[model samples]
Target: MGVYSEGFLEAVDAALADFEVEIRQLGAAASDAQILAAIERVVLALNSVSQGVAGGVIDTDEREQLCLFIDEVMTENGIEVGELAARHGVSRYAITDRWRRW
Candidate 1:
């Protein structure tokens, strides 16, 4: 089994739920394998969204909301500030500064 936390799993589930309708629509015409592949892509895209937010690739009004979601998930999972900073190639202070404003 994977070592994902409850918070992380919940986040993934929520993200997937957002696409449930579309996925079901595709399932109507697609083969089972194709449907599965589409679901996998959705998961991958959701994962990329988080990475993009962390690496500062996203630049829109929604960025702050996405950042806050990421922060909440990380906090719930007990991820250290320094670890998140290192993952994003940023400083620990930068992470704390953003959190402080939230």
Candidate 2:
């Protein structure tokens, strides 16, 4: 068992799936604009999930999994997280920190 419920995990998976779709929809020549938009949406979705789960409060374990999830999704879509963070002047682990209220 994990720190999150099955429903919570499902929501996270759906968010990631939608993110992949959004990126692929822009085709192989995905604009940086497209990438950034999709990133924002997914991060928002994760934030919503957290809110729905427990008043937007993410525990330590849930936060770890959520961060890992974003990193993997970005890498899978050929989005270099290092460069993404560099552009925002944040750490790679902080990629999802912008919209992550929890």
Candidate 3:
């Protein structure tokens, strides 16, 4: 089982929301798949946001990679993950269970 701290999850959620808003602004329709895809893209974009936080223009690819990396880090940190997973409309167990497939 992987873990994720509350703070980290909050940051990720905030970042994901930002990413979703941007995608919608780009003219993507409001569908289940589109929403999900937009979220994934935004998570990927988290790397860029992290970089930009340190003074950069936000490389989109970097953001994606950073998010993936963060999840691993969260697991290593031993923070109880899955609580925030429910926000995505899935069970906390499912979110933390083999979540990489998402």
lDDT of each: 0.47, 0.74, 0.46
Model 2, residue pairs in steric clash = none
lDDT string, candidate 1, 47-71, tens digits: 5654533332333444455445544
- Which 10 consecutive residues of model 2 have the lowest summed lDDT? 53-62
The numbered model that scores best in lDDT is 2
Q: What is the per-residue lDDT of model 3 for residues 27-56, given as tens digits with 9 covering 90 to 100? A: 423444544454456545554444334333
Q: After superposing candidate 2, which stretches have Cα over 4 Å from the reference?
A: 1-3, 53-57
Q: Which portions of model 1 show Cα errors greater than 4 Å?
A: 1-13, 16-59, 91-102
TM-score for every candidate vs. truth? Answer: 0.32, 0.74, 0.31
**Which number leads on TM-score?**
2
| Clash counts for the predictions, in order | 0, 0, 8
For 20-48, candidate 2 gives per-residue lDDT tens digits of: 77766754467666666777898898888
**Which of 1 and 2 is ahead in lDDT?**
2
